[model samples]
Target: MELDSEIKDRSRESPSPEVGIDGRDRSASTTRPTLILYSHGRTPPLNPPPDLKYDLRSIPNPPKNARDAHDGRSKRLREHLLGELKFVQKLDEVESEILEAMEAKIVETAEKLENDQDRRDDGEESRENGEEEGYESLEDEYDPTEAVLRVGCNCALGHHRSVAFVEELARRKWPRNWSVQLIHRDIDRRRGNDKKVRGKSLRWGGA
Candidate 1:
């Protein structure tokens, strides 16, 4: 999608990155659109890849022993990382990029709807005469609930830094109309071992 430059070019409106979470109540139905946030390790998911990626390798990690006791989902570990000033700055940067991408998607969807309406208007006369060509409609490609952005946050082992960052990101205020999905791909897969760790479901509040 050439997301960075292309999104900026197509977006007619620029929203501030500091916008707070929308307090409006929203349903998790097909009528509501989505914004996916993915957290992973060194290797990122290829299918349905992210529009923006943030590397968290530089963020300070907690103690080595902490990996055994806690993954990034732990509040203790999250605070440990957030305690660093540099990490907070990085988070701010990520938020700005995500907002910009979302704005682009909104603009693109509006344009698509407008174009489809224009096509229908032009074909009105032909339809009345029963001479309109059988052609696919642009409306078929429109999905009101499709995902607007897939943002990836990665670190050395998806268990720690990336998990914390993505979890924290989700808690922040977002547009009420947009739903955020968090995926910690490698959280169960630990380092130096292929064995998987089974744990309770990770809870995402107000997702």
Candidate 2:
């Protein structure tokens, strides 16, 4: 029954050397190749880290005060344009009314003048019809043909003959019915002849 003190002391101080089932030291054998376990049939689960999370509401929007100001400005501009349109329409109506009144006044004045002339013509016709027989009309006593004269001169005399002829006719009181018109030489040349001085002269002398 006596225990070995040395063996008891070694067991209490450290673990025993590992042994294979065959009674050989396990550490003295070669190491086994490392085995990597992979989950080939399933995809990796997606788990974004906490630091990657974002808050969209943190971004700033346009100021509410500025938006309200822009809306008010647009409304005022629209109202101003509408007011101007109304004013222009009223001005156009006033102008049209004025023009219409002026045209009417002009037409009324013209009609009145025409009526006055017609009344005067009627009165003169009636007076003429009431006259007695053997009374001559004033127009019938006046002779338009007596106021004109006709004279001719040879072409060789040039315009001088026409001027002299007019002077002589005037001295004889023939100018009262006559007027001189120069017949140009070029005009007669085109007609295969030379120009001759010709005029109309009227005289009160016996024929």
Candidate 3:
């Protein structure tokens, strides 16, 4: 009887078996992974920590002299306009080029979403192959933390750059479940009784 009791006690002390979808024992981690969407100078009010933070300025081909340190597919409006400073502000060529580039970039980014071979299973320490380029370990690469990812930016007028990117990212296929919420720092900063708003807000529907 005493031997049976000792065996029972040891069983209780031993770690519980946890098998992941890949049939390997899961790590001792039970944290929910997070994907943050934020901009510079516009942090969320609660100041929550995020596992991954992608600034709107870091994406390739960003508007010149706009990004401070780091990134994304922010509309290069200033660039489009500045290049046409010599011509009238209503230049059709500039508008067409910007529109075309923006559309192409959106499609390109979308296509690159699920192009990884093992993004799903390789998220844990039980990696089957070598580590990916941007990640340190399978744990760091696929850490699941139960936390809200705060995203903010210096979009003074709103509905131009950061807002657009957030909207676009929300539509992408993430490796994990991500509930994205947008909080335009200056959603109404540009609106007033003066009747001067941030001009036309472009609704990038399918474009």
Give the top-scoring candidate (TM-score).
1
Q: What is the C-alpha lDDT profile of model 2 across 32-83, one tens digit per residue?
A: 1111111010111112211111111221222455333432113342233225
Q: Comparing candidate 1 with candidate 2, which one achieves the higher lDDT?
A: 1
lDDT at 106 for candidate 3? 31
Q: What is the TM-score of each candidate against the true structure?
A: 0.72, 0.21, 0.30
Question: What does candidate 1's lDDT look like per residue over 1-207, in tens digits?
Answer: 232233334333213332323432222122334677777778635357778888899988888887678888888888888898878898888888787777665555545555666777777867888876566665566664454677888898688888888877776666555655677877787667766543233332122
- For each candidate, the alpha-carbon lDDT, in order, equals 0.66, 0.27, 0.36
Worst window of 10 by summed lDDT in candidate 2 = 33-42
| Pairs of residues clashing in candidate 2 | 147-177, 148-177, 149-200, 149-201, 149-202, 150-200, 150-201, 151-199
Pull out the clashing pairs in model 1: 21-173
- The runs of at least 3 residues in candidate 2 whose Cα sits more than 4 Å from the true structure, single-residue gaps closed, are 1-87, 131-207
Ordered from best to worst lDDT, the candidate numbers read 1, 3, 2
Q: How well is each residue in 23-96 modelled by candidate 3, as lDDT tens digits?
A: 54533433332334543223333245432333333323334455432222343543432353332232333334
